[model samples]
Each structure stands twice: as structure tokens, then as C-alpha cells.
Target: MNSNKKIIITAIDQRSTVAIVFQTITIGLIMIGSAVGNIGILLAIYKTKSLQNKTSIFVANLAVADLLAGLLIMPFMFICSIIGDWPFEDASCNLTGTFALILGAAGMNTLGAIAYERYCAIVHSMVYHLKITNRLILIVITFIWLEGLVLSLCPILGWSEYIYYTNEYLCTVNWAHDVSFTYTIMVVMYFLPLGVMIFCYASIFKVARRHLRQLAMLDTLSPPSSHNQIVSDSDTQPRIENSARSLRLKRDIKAASMLFIVIGTFVLCWTLHGCTMMCLALGDTCPVDFPEYVYTMTTWIAMFNSVCNVWIYGMMNRQFRDAFRSLCCIACLRSSNTQVIQI
Candidate 1:
């Protein structure tokens, strides 16, 4: 080749190499961080009694699902990015792609369950305890997992099938083929769960607003005690009125706050991808083609929803933080002991 042509080819090769390396490192780090964060939260929940509850169990299920995605799915995606092709054979692609889809579906379903749990606790406070038992929660979780598993397995069983996208550098459900099946799956798995989440959170927020308004009214009625006035039982009526529901209300409020953050983040991360998927499903051809980096970035952002949950829930709860600290201390002690023995 001439010097000028050779220089152009070298620059192109260099750019491609740099892009692959950057994508590989970025996804690898994301996987590591998500794995570590989710594992820490799991251990924290196991070790801390106070962190164990119906809602926490559901949240932990989400973490477990997301952790598996980070461990199984994201690595394969990064590998595809590096290789610039789908290196795996048909069976491997199907298995990994099915799993990735299953976990994602499960995570969203679990979030909907959490929203419903919060709604029940806040809106129908009277019957919430009776309605939301540990046994019942476990049953619901089992149903969520089973639903995702069944839907995910449909493709593997040859209902829809899996395809490795060369351009995007990922393996996912073959939604581009069989528009009818794609729309059906979208409605059953994605749209239904999304609708449930919206409804539950909306109801919870409405109840929260009403509760806050009531609290305000109560506060307004209870005037500050004057220095000259003698202390009276009437002065403490507001406290008496609040005492019954205060703890439960406060707990629900925190639960709502934490879960809201999670849902908001999840939606933010996945909205673009979801929209793109829907748009493609409706069109005659999957016309939307993003550049490699843009597609990869969007997918990773959605994957991040899984990793971010443990941090969101942990940060909001003191018990979880303490448990995480204890776990850290134990890890440190083990490292120190190993060093001493080596010495």
C-alpha cells in the first residue's frame, strides 16, 4: 500500500481497537461493581435480623436476579464487543440470552410486587398485616420467578427463538422476527408489569399525600404550649392521636421513598431501550439502528438498574448499613489473619 493509504488504514484499525478496549473495560468494571454491591447486600441481609422482612425479601430477590445478569449476561455481551462477533454457538447463545431476558423480566416483576406491597401497607393499612404475610410474599415471589422463567423458556423451546445481533454486539430475544409473538411477549412481560408498577406507585403516592395533609391538619390544631399555661392532658392530644399509627406510617413512608428511587432509576435507565424495542416491534422492519457504542451504553444503563438497588435500599436503611459494616470488618479481620500467618 502507498504511505497515504497505509496511514488511513492504520488510523481506522487504531480507532476500532481503542473502541473495543474501552467497551471491554467499561462493561467489565460494571459487572464487577454490580456483583460486589449485590453480594454485599445479600450477606448483609442474611447476617442482620433487622433487615429481614417481607419487603426486604422481595428486594433481595431483585438483587439476586440482577447479580446473575451482571455475572452471566453482561460478561458475554462484553466478550461479543471484544471479539466483534458472536463467538458462541447456537446453544450457548440461546442459553445465555434466555437467562438474561428472564432475569430482566423477573427484576421488573419484583419491582412491581414491591410497589404493590408498599401500596397495600400505606393505602389499606387496616388489612395490610393480614394481607401481606411472609408465606404470602414467598408465594408471590415464586410466582414472579416462574412467570419469567416460563416466558424466557418460550424462546429456547422454539416459540420465538434467540438471535445474536452482530451490529449491536449482544444476544437477546429475537423480537425482530415474529412480530405477533413479540407484541404478545411485550404485553405479557413488559407492558403488564410496567402498568402494575405505575398503578401501585400512583395509589401509594395518593395515600401518602392524604396522610401528610392529615398530619398537617393535626399539627395546626395543636397550638404551642404557653410558658404561663399549666400543662394539661389536652395539650398532648396530638401526640396521643399520632402514637398509634406513627411507627407504621414512618416505616411505610421510608419504604415508599426507597422504592420510588428504585423505580425512578429503573425507568430512567430502561425507558429508551423499552421505547426502541416497542418501536421496532410495531414497524415492518427493525429500522432503528444505533451505532455500536450507543447501543452498548444503553444496554449497560438498563443493566445498572439491577446493581443500583442494593445501594439504594442500603443507603436508606440504617440496619442494612450496620450489617454491611460488620461484614466489612469480618472481611478485614480475615485478611489481617492471613497476613499474620504468612509472616
Candidate 2:
């Protein structure tokens, strides 16, 4: 009996050690990936003049929020996961929670803004340039940040409480303590923006498909001219203009599709985490008891969305891809110059 007890204790100890190591490695990877990817996005937008458009502005704002999450929140999470508890004082925990909330809200709102921008560009092409000015976009982004700050501060102002959960091993709003706050955030920050994105993207695609069908009909109806036929400059000019418009429309649709992918990924990454938190807030009324690790895992999955956006941009946007390549080349040259100077 003594030998059996000793063996069980040793096995449990080994399992705990393994879990710690795994958590540390996973968190560390997420931190590094998010930091590096978001930084690359910022640099790509800054260095490439072609990418400095209204949509890019919203993308840059999102990158900034994600960057902060990577640089601040993830490292703290890594430490806490490794130690198996929140090591910081109460004040520090509150700050971390507020920062996380701000970033989360800001990022989601930025995505909604991007979707709206695309919607106008495609559906209201005639007035898009006149209405969606840089000044207006800047004002919208300012409001997004302000709203995030105000909502995030509610907990500190006594509306709710930020506390560390032992199971999750990180500091955040105590959902079970204030179910109202949890529900509010879920409905306002997550679902509202999610609904906006869905509507905007859906409308944008509907317009795109209609335009494509029209273009196809035009192509089919137009008569093919013989090689010997003489074409007037006025006749040729209208065709050229129509062709240009068609190309621009296609490009806009493609860009919207890429952004839709980013929004879809966000929904997939966060929905599970949001549902789990809501369930926890429901307390005894909830049918299922989620494992402690489920919370931690879902949280990590949601945070990983920050890192995924950078890759998606690189792969989908030609301007971003070119900008990333240029940046990499510059960095390599600088590194070589440094080595030469040392030699």
C-alpha cells in the first residue's frame, strides 16, 4: 500500500511538471508570433505608400491593439501560467485586465469599421471617395479607442470587478461575480460588431455578385469587331473606361473577400471562449461544467487570432506582400552591413 501511494504521487508530480512546460511553451510561442506579426504589419503599412489608404488605416489601428496585447498581456499570461497563479498585486491585475479589455474591444470595433469601409467602397462607389475621407476615418478610429477605454474602465469604477481566476491563471473581469457585466460585454462588444460585420460583408458580396453578372452579360452582348473595321476614338474611349471600371470593381471585391476571412477567423476563435464565459456566468443554471483547462485553452485560441491576421494580410494583399518582402530585404542588408563593420 505504501509503495502504491508513492508511485501515484510521483506520477502526478511528473504530469504537473509536463503541463507547466507545455503551457509555458504555448504561451511563449503565441507572444512571440503576435508581437512579430503585428510589428511587421505596422511596418508594412508605414513603409509602403500604396498601402496608406482608408482600409489600411483601420488595419493599422487593429494591428496596434493586437501589438499591445502581444507585448503586454501575453508575457504576463506566460509568467502566470508558468507559476500556476497570478503573481502580481491587485493593482497590477486590474491594470492588466483593463488593458486586455481595451485591446479586445478596440480590435473588434476596428474590424467592423473595416467591413463598413469596404461596404461603402463597393456598394456606394460613386460617393465613397467623397464621403470616406481620411479625416473622417481618423475621427472614427478615435471614437473606437475612446469607447474601448470607457467600457474597460467600468470594472475599476465599481460596475464590476477584475480578479484572477485560479483555473485560468490570469486576471480578467470576474464574470461569475457580475453576470450582468459579462452579458453586456458579450452583447455589446462581441455580438454587435459581429452582426455589423456579417451584414456589411453580406451586402458587399451581394453587390459584387450582381456586378459580376452584369459584366458577364455585357461581355456576351457586345459584338466582336472585324480586324479591318475602323474604330472611332470616342467609341474606343467609352469601352476603355468601362473596362477600367470593371477591373477596379474586381479588385475591390477581392480585397473585401480577404477582410471577410479575417472577420470569419475572429468569429471562430472567439465564439467558443465567449460562450464558455457566458456559461460560467450562468452558474447553477448552466448544464455543463467546463474543465478548467478549457478556459485557458479557449483564451489562448482567441489570442492567437492576433497572430493570424498578419499572415492573412501578407498572403492576400499584393501591396502588403511586396511591402513585407521589401522590409525583409532591407533588414538583411542592414544585418550584413553590421557584420561587415564588426569585421
Candidate 3:
């Protein structure tokens, strides 16, 4: 009996050690990836002049938010995860919690803004350039950051509160502190932005489909010899202009599709965390017991979304992919040159 008990205890200890090591490695990778990926995005946008456009401005803002979260929030959480406790003071906890909230709110708001931008560019192409000027885009981004700052400050201002959870080993807004505050965050941060993204994407999709159908109808009605026939200069000019417009429309649709994927991934990664928080805020009315690890895992999952956006851009956008490739090649050449000089 004594031998069996000793074996059981030893096995449990080994398992715990393995779990810790795995978690540390996973979190460390996420932190490094998030930082590197977001930085790469900002660099690509800066170095590639073609990428410096109205849409790129919003992309850069999102990158800044994710980059800050990766640097400020993830590093502390990584250390605490390794230490298995919050080793910092209460003030540090509050700071991290507030930053976490601010970055998250900023990211969601930026996504909503991007969706609206795409909607206008595609659905209202005639007025898009006149209405969505660079100056206006800058103002919109400024508003997004300010909105995030004000909402995040609410907890610090005593509307709710930030507290360190021992089980989670990180500081965040206390969902149970005030149900009303929790609901407010849900409405402002999650639901409102999500609604905007959904509505915009839906409208964009409808326009794209209508364009496709019209093109198909035109093809069906046109004479088969139209492609080969010589035409007058007057007719040729109009055809050229129409062709240019169609190409631009196609490009816009492709970009919108990629952004829709990003939004979908964000929803997938955050839904569980959002639902869990709502339940916690409900308290007795919810009456569901959640394991401490669940909280930790859900938060980590949401944080991982920051790491995904850059990858999605690199994979889906040709311009981004080319820029990334060029950057990587330059980096490799620099490393080789340095090694040769050292030798």
C-alpha cells in the first residue's frame, strides 16, 4: 500500500512538471510570434510605398495595438506563468489589466473601421475617394484609440476593478466585480463591433454577387465575334474604361474576402472567452462552476488572435506576401554578410 501511494504521488508530480513545461513553451512562442509578426507588418507597410494607402493606415493601427499587447501584456503574463503566481505589485496588475483592455478594445474597433472602409470602397465607389480621404482616415483612427482609452479607464476609475487571479496568474478586469460593467463592456467592445463587421461584410458580399451576375449576363448577351472585331476609337475607349473598372471591382472583392476571414477567425477565438465572462458576471443566476484553468486557457486563446492576423495577411494578400519575402531575403543577406566579415 505504501509503495502504491508513493508511485501515484510520483506520477502526479511528473505530470504536473510536464504540463508546466509545455505551457511555458507554448506561451513563449505566442509572445515571440505576436511581436515579430506585428512588427513585420508595420515594417512592410512602411517600406512598401504601394502599401501606403488609406486601407493600410487602418492595418497599421491594428498592428500597433497588437504589437503593444504583445510587448506590454504578454511578457508579464509569460513570466507569471513560469513563476505560477503574480509576482508584481497591485499597481503593476492594474497597469497590465488596463493596457490589456485598451489594446483589445482598440483592435476590435479597428476591425470595425476596416470593414466600413471596405464597404464604402466597394459599395460606394463613386464617392469613396472624396469621402474617405487620408485626413478623414487619420481622424477615424484617432477616435478609435481615444475610445479604447476611455473605456479601458472605466475599471481603473472604479466603475468595476482590475484584480489578479491566482489561478490565471495574470491581472485582468474582474468580471464578477460588477455585472453591469461587464455587460457594458460586452455591448461596447464585443457586440457593437461584431455587429458592424457582420453588416458591412454582408453588404459587400451582396454587391460582389450582383457584380458577378451582371458580368455573366453581359457575356451571355454579347456577340461571340465581339472579342475579335475591330471597333472605332470612341467604342474602344469606353471598353477600356469599363475593363479598368471591372478589374478594380474584382480587386476590392478579393481584399474584402480576406478581411472577412480575419473577422471570422477573431470571432472563433473570442467567443468562448466572451461566453465564460458573461457567465462569471451573472454569478448565481448562471450557477455554473468553471475550473480556474478554463479562465487561463480562454484568455490565452484570445491573446493568440493577435498572432494570427499577420499570418493571415501574409498568406492571403499578394502584396503583403511579396513584401514579406523581400524582407526575409534582405535579412538573410545581411546575416550572411555579417558572418563572412566575422570569419
Q: How accurate locally is residue 336 in candidate 3, as Cα lDDT from 0 to 100?
A: 100
Per-residue lDDT of candidate 3, residues 160-229 (tens digit): 8887665555677888878888988898888888999998888888888887776666555542346678
Which candidate tops lDDT? Answer: 2
TM-score order of candidates, top first: 2, 3, 1
- The candidate scoring highest on TM-score is 2
TM-score of 3: 0.90
Query: Whole-model lDDT for model 2 versus the true structure?
Result: 0.81
The better candidate by lDDT, 2 or 3, is 2
Question: Between 1 and 2, whose lDDT is larger?
Answer: 2
TM-score of 1: 0.88
Could you tell me which 10 consecutive residues in candidate 2 have the lowest summed lDDT? 1-10
Q: Candidate 2: TM-score?
A: 0.91
What C-alpha lDDT do the candidate models reach, one value each?
A: 0.75, 0.81, 0.80
Candidate 2, residues 19-94, lDDT tens digits: the string is 8899889989989998988999999999999998888899899899999999879888998777765667667888
lDDT of 2 at 222: 54
Off by over 4 Å in 2: 1-15, 226-229, 232-238
